[model samples]
Target: MPKPVLIVGAGLSGAVIGRELAEAGHVVHIIDRRSHIAGNCHTARDEASGVMVHVYGPHIFHTNDDEVWRYVNRHMTFMPYVNRVKTTSAGQVYSLPVNLHTINQFFDRTFRPDEARDFIQSQSDPSIGEPVTFEDQALKFVGRELYEAFFEGYTRKQWGCSPADLPASILKRLPVRFSYDDNYFSHLYQGMPEHGYTEMVARILSHDNISIELERNFVRSDAGDFSHVFYSGPLDGYFDYELGRLGYRTLDFEEFQYDGDYQGCAVMNYADADVRYTRVTEHKHFSPWESHERSVCYREYSRACGPDDEPYYPIRLSGEQALLAQYVARARFEQGVTFVGRLGTYRYLDMDVTIREALDTARSCIRAFADGLPLPAFNIEP
Candidate 1:
């Protein structure tokens, strides 16, 4: 019998890689420090409300990659879901993405798409030739009024930093539309797994040749037992933070249950500086197809990640990036192991990106094995 390939962290990265390798006739052992199969995307039923709650937070799978979309559908049924985000700012509710509807609603005027576009252009700061910071990007794109009402306070609260401190790339993810399309993402496919993320991940790891061990804290010593190690855990954690811990923002969710609908939406952003929490997400609205009498909601608070806290978002500022480069250099020299996934790469990755990269990494590993070459430290560079 061949030595089993060891995959640390049973999240999408490890699970997908393990499934691919196992299908190709390699025995794979996948493990997670957490007892659950799915990582942050873990979803389960709330006994009190009988609603499927996103235990960590809401994860709506949206992607433009047809192959990746098909890959997930093969594992489980995906129910149609479009994230129509709503925001409350200064005692007024508005459609998110700063759409034409939002503009007209905010100004209390009816304007056509072209008229709205012209009006926003007038509002935009012509002085900003090129946006370098998040603040600059917002001011150049949507101008002061819209930026202050929609992005400024929300961003400050979410990242726990001034908008000027963040890169322009952060604001680029959001689009200011001239149309009434309130859909949060412009992806080709958008949905949630019908049975829940946990079930979907479980099915992904259900191959006979793939064995999963939960609550197992994988260490460097365990690498000798396997042919190769695929680590999806935090890159810094893998090295015991020898180069110092990478900065990250962890979320504090205050969960509460309410009768019937709480906010009448899946997500509601509190776009006000006075608002302590960034957003409130109602779990039942995540699966609108399902009927529930009660709803479960979470008021999300963001803060600097501590040692024991579960890191949510990587704060890849200049300092953190410099530290990450050092870790990446160290990882390149490490033998018999390959770092994979969001934490491994120390980047914010969506579910689709994670799956796509995992698939690519698995293929590379298989090719490297066939060619009698050592597996690369990272398939996708951080």
Candidate 2:
């Protein structure tokens, strides 16, 4: 008889992997430190407002992968959603991602697309060849005026660092559209789960062969009870931070209640250093399908992650990468355990990518089990 598999953390990674393995005839036991499922993407309805509030923050589902899109749809219904981000800079609202409309509004000019492109090109620093930092990238891409107006202060507040200190790749994530299209994401599919992420995750983990235990932490001794373990907890945490802690930025949300609409949008970025909070998220706006007289909003602030704080974004600066390399080397040697998910891999991952990796990992593990071989430490490199 095959021994049951143990999965740490009942988040997307663990749930998806457990479901896949259960269907393959393996008994799966999943556990999470938190009382509820759906790690960071947990969504719950406000009793008073009857609004589905994004507990951690807003998680807009946008994916180019057809398989991932279909997989999510099979479990829950997704309503059409297109994120149109807005930024407040110098007491004025501007369209985000520096689109054609934004350029015209910011500069107070009605230049055509070609003219706008040429004007921006002329404004950009011609001396810079191959940008290496966030500030440099912004200047090269949109010139100093736009960079200072939109990205400079926001990046500082969100990352807890100056734009000049951050890597150029960080700025590359944001797209600068030439047209009037204000859709924040360029993905083929974009939507929000009709019932919320928690309900969707519950459906994903509804396999008969799978069992879950929440508010339970994984111990080192527990590894011996199962044939193999899929650990989706923190990578540094697994080793008890033996090589010292890795750098991460954690978010502090100052939630406020309002009788009427708050921001009038799902997310609003404060592109000024004067504003202590990076962005404000009005939860009610997230689910336009549901109406709510009262709204729940969060003024999000980012800071250095402490020992007890829930780590949000991994600070992959040079020093952190050096420390991460050591942890990765250590994780590779662990027997009968595989590190998975955002925390385990120490990288920022979108929901679709996380599910995709989990599915692939389960298939790989099944092959290993059939061949009577040891389980892999990591299906994807950290």
Candidate 3:
């Protein structure tokens, strides 16, 4: 180790990796281009509303993994949060996830669970045995009307592509409940950090040896030090795009203020394809424990990431995967720098996966150092 390891980006992934390495008796330096830590998960009180608001968007922590649930619980006090989502489609407001209530209400029927299932099955076509596109998957699983009402337009709006063009696997988790459960996710544990995500991340970097430098930009040429480097920044940037750049989607949030309450729900998705925006997130509902007379809301718009936008979701198109493979090949030939995290690996990962991966990366680094083995370029494949 020549110098302390340099970890670029102070987001959840970078913070986790740095904390793990520092705890394992390795020096780490974290540098992020943003002025604040915690990346997009940053939350703070809106001075006017006096409510904890998610600056980027509403990021509810929900995961089924036991270890991941325990890992986050250790740092921050998590208050139970069930993301009850609704959608306004064709001038009708209904529960999301194609639940029994949504289906019964949307179709103006009072059918019981068994009757609802029979009715939906009757509407579904028996001809298509295998589904390929998002449209096919939704129709095959939840019937044509519910698919059009809930997913078809919404998927197109969110992904900026036709539902027919999207992969069927994307719609595999289309929640169709036999009961009337409106909570968006079926994860066992769901909550938001009591103090907020930023506080949790800052606590993670509270070690003496792990230093952080915000508002600083790092260049690829200077990645030479500390026996190895842990690169959590964008992988395409790391390799300087030896292949062409990957496709990504970034969200644009429009802020609005209101008195008393806003939508009365956390997220109100506009599922109709005609609607330009995806969903409007009311920040007040995110922190149910906190009472605020005024409220903060964000109208979220999804667009294809340009050269200048902050990439949120990796498109991971077939061509981009091939390009990523090329970058992976080039990265393997390089000396020290391990790619770990969402942007680094170019995969859409929630907080739990990032935390687990960072912990694993640190352990891998320790093993490589002890055995005198060459450091890995990437701990996880994109």
- Which RMSD does model 1 reach against the true structure? 0.8
Q: Can you rank all candidates by lDDT, best first? A: 1, 2, 3
- Could you give candidate 2's per-residue lDDT for residues 84-146 as a string of tens digits? 899999999998878999999999999898999999999999988989999999999789999
Question: What are the lDDT scores of the predictions, listed in order?
Answer: 0.94, 0.92, 0.85
Candidate with best lDDT: 1
- Screening candidate 1 with a backbone cut-off below 3 angstroms (N, C-alpha, C), the clashing residue pairs are none
Instruction: Give candidate 3 regions above 4 Å deviation.
Output: none
- Mark the regions of model 1 whose C-alpha exceeds 4 Å error after superposition: none
| Candidate 1: tens digits of C-alpha lDDT, residues 1-382 | 8799999998999999999999999999988999899899999999998999999998999999999999999999999999999999999999888899999999898999999999999999999988999999999988999999999999999898899999999877659899999999999999999989999999999999999888999889999999999999999999999999999999999999998899999999999999999999999999989999999999999999999999999999999999999999999999999999999999999999999999999998999988899999999999
Sorted by TM-score (best first), the order is: 1, 2, 3
Write the number of the candidate with greater TM-score, choosing between 1 and 3: 1
139: Cα error in model 2, Å? 0.6
Models 1 onward score TM values of 0.99, 0.99, 0.96
Error of 1 at 2 (Å): 2.0
